[model samples]
Target chain A: MSTVRVENIKKTYEKGQVLALDDVSFEVKSGELFGLIGPDGAGKTSLFRILTTLLVPDAGRAEVAGLDVVKDLWKIRQIVGYMPGKFSLYQDLSIEENLNFFATVFNTTVAKNYHLIEEIYVQIEPFKHRLAGKLSGGMKQKLALCCALIHEPKVLFLDEPTTGVDPVSRKEFWDMLDRLKARGITIVVSTPYMDEASRCDRIALIQKGKILELDTLEQIIARHAQNLYAVDADNRYNLMNDLRKNTEIVSAFAFGEEQHVTLPPHFQDEYLSAFLKEKGHTGIKVRKIAPTIEDTFIKLMLENQ
Target chain B: MRNLVFLLQKEFRQIFRNPTILRMILIMPIMQLIVIPLAADYEIKHISISVVDQDHSTYSSKLVNKMTASGYFQLVEYTQSYAQATKTVGDGKTDLILTIPAHFERDLIKFNKAQLHLAADAVNGVRAGLGTAYAAQMIGDFNREIREEWMLLPKFNEMPQIEITSANWYNPHFDYHLFMVPGILAILVTMVGAFLTALNIVAEKEVGTIEQINVTPLKKHEFILGKLIPFWVLGMVSITLGMIVTFVIFRFLPVGSFFTIYAFSAVYMFGVLGIGLLISTFADTQQQATLFAFFCMMVFILLGGLYTPIESMPEWAQWLTRINPPAYFIKIIRAVYIKGSAFSDLIPEFLVMIAFAVGFNALAVFNYRKRSA
Candidate 1:
């Protein structure tokens, strides 16, 4: 069954000058870890706010756990957990106090559902007496998650929960989400990092307030995958500027030390090397590479444009 | 109800943990209650007078002596040149000039009356008016004494005289402290209640905590009341502290029952705090909230009739005071504290205060939406 059903949702701000969401629609099945993957200003936060009933859609409807986002807001509020993109916990309160406060606000007790957050809580429990403001970034995130989950909400909405977190903590956070999913909780998480898209069971790639692609990880890449190439040169910067100058190159984006690019169908690698050699380039090497989710995302973004 | 308990607990914990708020709630009232009353005393004294005594007679000297001995005026210039005295008045050195013409007490002995001239610098109208009145009173007393001595005493029943006796009621000594303490206390309670509740919710918005709270199932009134109740308790504690300071510094205690004051304050706080909540609902940031709160408080306090009597205000201003929440409370507090008025006697003010509380709070709760538009 669909736990969340969004139908052609449209939202705008500043007297309709800025369109935040346009005809956005999707569904999250029960116990599914659905991801909304997009860059900043992609309407991810706006969509989450609408589904969580914190905002009203300008011209569409949404539901959470079969409860209408507008008419049944009170019922939805009791069942859904929303951790906003910004750190919203009271900074002056202790970790334990913050957790207990949210629990009580939901008309439940922390002791009643202590096992739900126990895995994440035990890590932060050592510093439970410390003020939330005093904790490091990763610990603050964990405490926020614990507070959001204290009532064992059926649907959890986490907006960019891993944005500012370090790599190791980000991995640990995903592990915690995996465990929560095992307990049959539906989660809708949004992130700006394209690499994290694979961590979800399904993702809807959103851009400019519109969903570009929505599919399973393998299905999305298989349907739109192309022959991507990673090229290296003596100078990475010059290599990128040089590659963009060629009409044969579909797109070239700098990815760390190597520049990943898509070439025209049936284009020979030697022809590119020969073309660069004529432009005073030397020691150029190119090889075929598997397309990453980021590469697929870039291709979809280019196609939409 | 359970949700409200948690919300209240969180608000109180945050309030107590903030040292700045702690000091504001505890220290501000006592300090202002003690210092403002002492500096705001309105009984005018020490008027400087220049006596241009052209007639150096005994009566002229006696009148000047009586003026100085009255403790209201000082004999600054005793010059024969009226130009010099006029110059002193122009220079702001003297506040008044009394000219005893060259009668030399001859006119008083020969005729039944003598002429004397008194001129006051009417720059500061109140000071000049009062100084002139004091001088005229001393001269009148001297004239009466002269008539009693120089002329034969009138027959006991020859002149029919109607004597008027008057007594000061309420504050018998006209104690400025007693009159000002309760009024100032009313303002202090108002300021604390209004500003604190105004900033509380907005501060949560700034810190981004309201977003989380808004997503929860906590009802609108529960959240607002949670913000209010703690500050309401603090406001009452402030009034108690201010009263203690009033007694400690001035040895003045209210003649009315303390229960009446608390009952009135309880109702008064709801109205004042309701205004603060109303402002909070309209503002998005702490800066906006503080500015809105300051604007409302300035209007309420200025028109509150604490500094000026409502009857003396212009008709429009008096009309405005009728709607001012603090004005009603200030009048109620002063009446109860000084006039020993019981709560039953202040039914009209109580009714008005209840209206304000209900009207403002309803508007606030209605304006506050758990869902964004």
Candidate 2:
């Protein structure tokens, strides 16, 4: 059974002038770690808000844990724990107070759910007497997670939790999420970081309130029909400029140290290397490589445009 | 019910944790109750007058003496020439110039009438108007005293005179603070209820914590009740504090039952806190809510008959007070405190308060969107 199901959800803002979510629909299976991958203002937060019962979708039905979002919002609220993108715990409240408050409000206590948040809470336990606002970003993240899990929610929704976090803490947060998922909790998280997509069981790539693709990391990359090659040369900018000026290349962008490009059916890497050498005599390397989720997102964006 | 208890606990914790808000809840209202009524005393005390006695008759001198003895006026200058007295008025030395005409005493004995020229500097209009009215009353009393003297000496023509006796019943001394303390207490309570509640939900939204709370299973009415009850208690606390200050400094006590005052305040808190909630619902930020609540509070207090009587206001402003929640509280508070009025006498205001409590709260709760539009 699906833990969460959304069908034809649409949302708009600014009196319907800006389309925030456009007929967006997807499903998260029970106990699956699902990621909504998109850029800023790409309707990721809008979708999360709808699924968590914080918002009403314009034109669709969303069900969480077998209950309709709109009709059974109270029931959905109990089963889902939502961590908004911003740090929202009361600044004046001590860390322990914040945890206890969230737990008590949920009609549960920290001790009742102690084993669930035990791992994360221990990391923040030393600073339990400190104000929640005065904690470091990583500690705050853990505290937020602990609060969210205090009631042992069946599903958890995290919106851009690791956006501003350091890479090390980001990895730590993901690891903590992995343990929660092991306990059979369905996790739905949205992030703009393409690298995090690889950690999820399935991901729905959304943009402009529309879902472009929904599949696993391997499946999304495998589904890319065009062959991709990484082009490297001494002058990275010039290589991208030259590749873009050529009509034979489907799309070309400088990705870190090399340029990633898609090719036409008959395009050859040897020919491209020879062409770049002809323009400016230098050593060049061109080779085929697996596309990342970001590369796939760019390909999907180009196809839609 | 469980949700409400938890939510209230959270709100109270947050309120107590913030020292600034705690000060606002505890100290600011007490200070205002102490300071505002002192500056708000509207009674015109002493008006200086320059008298020009064109006629050096006994009655003219007696009238000047009567004006000076009234305690409301001071004889700043006694000049034979009107020009010198006008110079005193021009120098801002005296607030008014009183000129006695040439025939002063003979006319009152013969024609039973004499007119005095009184010119008041009307810059402070209320002061000038009340001073002139007071001077006129004093002159009338002087005329009656002379008439009574003439009647005792067996006048040739004893024209029948009507006597008017006036009494100041409720406040015999017309103590301004006695009249004002109850109204000030009502205002302090109104401000506490309105301003604090106006900022409550919006402050949560401003800090982005409202989204977290919204995602919880807390029911809408439970959340509103949670927010409402804490500030309702604070509102009553402000009134109680103001009453204590009123008692301490002014030695003034509410003439009516303390139960009546508290009962009315409890009901009035519902209406005032409803106003606060209504403000919070319409405002998105704490600053916006504060600005809006401040503006509305200014209008409500000014029109509330706290410092001024509503009967003396223009037709439309008096009408505006009908919708203002504080106005009814002010009236009921004054009626109960000064008039020793019973609950039945305040039934109309009580009914209006109940309506305001329900009406504003209903609109506020309706506007509090639990599910985002």
The candidate maximizing DockQ is 1
Give the number of colliding residue pairs in candidate 2.
0
Per-candidate TM-scores read: 0.90, 0.88
Residue-level error in angstroms, candidate 2, position A188: 0.9
Instruction: Judge candidate 1 at residue B75 and give its lDDT.
Output: 85
Residue lDDT tens for model 2, B24-65: 767876677678878888877779988988888998988898
lDDT of 1 by residue, A1-305 (tens): 99999999999999899999999889999999999999999999999899888889899889899999999989999999999999999999999999989998888899999999999999999999999999999999999999999988999999999999999999999999999999999999999998888899999999999999999989999998786888888877788888999888899998888889898878877777787788877779889898999999999999999
DockQ of each: 0.65, 0.57
Error of 2 at A54 (Å): 1.8
TM-score on 0 to 1 scale for chain A of candidate 2: 0.98
- The TM-score measured for candidate 2 stands at 0.88
Q: Show where candidate 2 strays beyond 4 Å.
A: A225-249, A257-265, A270-289, B46-124, B135-165, B344-348
lDDT of 1 by residue, B46-157 (tens): 9999999988988889888888998999889999988999999999999999988898588877886789888999999988988888888888788777766644565453
Alpha-carbon interface RMSD for all candidates, in angstroms = 1.5, 1.7
lDDT of 2 at B264: 87
